[model samples]
Target: MRVTSLLVATGVLLCSAPAAVAGPAVRIHDVQGTTRVSPLVGQRVTGVPGVVTGVRGFGSARGFWFQDPEPDGDPRTSEGLFVFTGEQTPAVAVGDVVAVDGTVTEHYPTAPEETPETTANQSVTQLVDATWQVTGRGAVPAEVVGPDSVPEEHAPLDGNIDKRELEPQRFALDHYESREGMLLRVDDARVVGPTDAYRALWVTSKPGQHANSRGGTTYTGYADPNSGRLKVESLADGPFPAADVGDLLRGSTEGPLDYTSYGGYVLEATRLGEHQPGGLQPESSRPQGEDELAIATYNVENLAPGDDPAKLDRLAEGVVEHLASPDVVALEEVQDNSGPVDDGVVAADETLGELTDAIAAAGGPRYLWRQIDPQDGADGGQPGGNIRVAFLYNPARVSFVDRPGGDATTPVHPVERLGGVGLSASPGRIDPGNEAWRDSRKPLVGEFLFRGRTVLVVANHFGSKGGDQPLHGRFQPPERGSEVQREQQAQAVRAFVDEALAIDERARVVVLGDLNDHGFSPAVQRLTAGGALVPLADSLPPLERYSYVYEGNAQQLDHVLATPSLRADYDVVHVNAEFADQVSDHDPQVARFTVR
Candidate 1:
């Protein structure tokens, strides 16, 4: 791994340091004999000093990494260096070089010839137990210079950087490669809206690392909007910043961003001109009323109640008071159980029972939730609390209709039964075929009547963190792999919408959930563009119109789109960060509308 070479070099330096005779340090040769030794294992030497090259804050405190540039042939190999943790500290940037005096300790060793890409190696590098102090300070050069300097291959155009927006994951990969090891300048970054922790800023830089299999190469000298600084990571010492966010980044050109990759990297951003404070305003100038229905969606930050029914009751009350108070609420990451599974529990009494009970207890209306039941035979969660998408609605405002051929007594897709017991029986099953159950997350659809008009509501939760493998076998290219499962979920909802439209051209429809894909993603676009379901907030500006924020940018992955007729009366009000902070990881988007 890249870090191994650095660490080996550091060991050599530490072993040879004591022999250096004091003076204006000149080139030192191997104080030790000429025989190469196996890399040091678990040596705990202390108080070596080096410059701070990088700093990362993972919420609570700042973590520092740096390099001690050694003279040529000093027996000190330039492999991995040291990292220290500082708690609740003031922020530190890239260019502000500080001397870190820490012990030379053995990092967890990797197996022979092991690659850095695997989880074992990744975890080992992040483990930090060493302690160090800031001994001295030096200012980094104002300009960056090197072969690793930002490349021109993927540079944004002269006047269009803000005109394009790429999907979140793809954008992260591209940005990572472009600025992996470069100095950068950022300006005027502020922690605005909701929580002060979420900082935003404009970035300027040359591109860095080249693209590799996992993703793009790290850009060496680009600015980070979130951290508000230029970044770098190197063995000689680094992960440093050239500038802070929100500062006027000079010597930069703006242009349209491009992301034409296969994992659907598409975004449309309008350049609103020169950077200015309080940049934009809401496009709609209408007032709102309490009687108008407000709909919110959230990925409810792992809202699972363990096994206890009482715990579920507590959870239900919270859900009712905070989440379901509005007219319609679409929730993702909900779990249920037929019973206990191997790792622990697999039941979802808390999500279903608690949520429903909470709504009723609050003296609010009842909610009808539909999910893929895993009891009979449908696949359940791998360990437990087989989570699924569910919907809660006020019965007084809407009622379900019986279709001509619809099976009212049976669910649309009944859980398949196996061996006289449901598939929920064994939660700890590790067979590859059993893994297929992960792909069975189904979309829940229901029809409700609002003021004599029938509106279709579809709630969905797609596949989670399985990493980029094609869907097993449902569709072919043009129609591809497991990604097809996501498409099918969208297609299922569209089919329901088509059915609604077939019955009446003016039929109203609203589709919402944790789609996993952004508004511009192929899966979402297939459902919204070209006179399909109209985007509810298309008239609103992007920032004011998002339900989720990630990696310094806001995205509307959880959405509420309406059929043409429903669009006229509805307007969206995105709550401020204060309100969203209490709700979930995803802020709820409330859509208020009047029934004509």
Candidate 2:
């Protein structure tokens, strides 16, 4: 928006701002106005008064944030502005008062890596194409964020988030919008989200917002995404601590709040709080009783044979120590022998063999695995990974019904054998041709014998939430586009379960895996439709239910469901999701049932 004169580009008039507006002295609050979007957007302003509060000297988004030292006293309008210099580092330092010349712009940002359609993030109001003159230095004021300021309600305009009036006193999102680019503080913050590879973590300004047992904020529903939850990333040099959930960032974490595509509203902190260990430990589910069969579901994040042997060893220990070596484990994201190398080798025997071998090495039961190799490039994941779902069962505890002729394309159906329910092909795919399973992992159904009773297990890895808009994206409530395919997938799996239970009304069928949707989501609802299966996640305490954490929100993406006929003792083993040095992104869930 640097055009000084009217210019035509591709037969379209491209202009920065009205020259009349450029001459007038407009304050930063006047530019930001009282809305999620700036009212003065696309208009050029001269002498927009503010003091440099924060300077982002690195990255592709180099800029300096300035705030008005004098307050407007309006709760809705923000008194701060971001002078986006693009890749050029800003010349001004913090506390230097400046008068700027720039065009007000609404920057629609995106997450650094949006799993879904690279959706547009909620617009971050910025002053672009700018030049500034240094005035006298001024004090930078930082407002404290707490329950007294931010509201319990998150977004006022749920789906239609942008261009709306900022109700700073009513909604938390609006309150954040009101403080855009301004210095803010979270005091004595509790680390709710574990520290990631990128020196960033999530903390809570308002504690007790569905605070999980282990300090992290629990996302109970779509309505309340925990407005207190704020992502914290340090602007100061030195390494960010490997902070886990339940850890404490004791004391003040002060910084200018900036919105990005990564997490919705981020506090690019100039001062991080003291790191205090919370002593949060990975949990282990109680071992199965002598007559009980324990089943677990874990997504070993894209594990391949060529991956570090330590990774396999870690996963093996998670199976043994964290999940108590369940009798049967349904594993997701098991890659082929050569991980991520596009040579078209689809067999995962070596990959699965290494995992089972590692389990034995870790002093776990001698586990045998069963799986049907999916056709190359058919099931979608990492391009060359060909990740698929497979089962690992302890031979000493349970027996796999190895009916032959199961392949990638052949669908497994329920059959009656010896007056009990069994699968047509023990290790067969379910409805691989369905449109629901297109570019997704097909369901793998297996029949098993536990204490002389027939048991059927259906393992599924649904289409990811990769195509859905983030919660903090432009759209309110966010668009779950991937849910369409996942819902269809749930239906396909539900139909399979229905057929199995139909064959035997009192049959023991366990449906589990990385369903990749919350228990409250439509996909999960459809999977448990008609009461064909009961979701075990729903039965757990809300604070203890989550199996995955993303962007500071502790949520569930993996589940164990069972038919009503089987009594279940279930626990979600908390291992990877809350820890920094995790082998997998997901924590495995184990369910036990007495068969004899």
- How far out, in Å, is residue 167 in model 2? 1.1
List, in order, the clash count of every candidate structure. Answer: 68, 7
For the record, the alpha-carbon RMSD of candidate 2 to the native fold, in angstroms, is 5.4
Measured against the true structure, the TM-scores of the candidates, in listed sequence, are 0.52, 0.94
The TM-score of predicted model 1 comes to 0.52
Model 2: CA > 4 A from native? 1-22, 111-118
Over 1-596, each residue of candidate 1 has an lDDT whose tens digit, in order, gives 01111124333211121222222211101111111111222233344444444554444423543434443432222222325343432234443333322222222223232342221211111213343334346532212322333233332222222223222122332242222111222222221222222222223232222211111121221232221112211121222122221222233221112111211111111111223233222122233354455555556545554445554443344445444355666677676544334444445555666667766776656776544344322433344555656666666655554333221123232112321111111111112132323455555555555666545566666554244421111011122244555665566566656655665666556677777665666567778856758766566544345554433234456677777776443433333222212335454554665544
Model 2, poorest ten-residue lDDT window?
Answer: 11-20
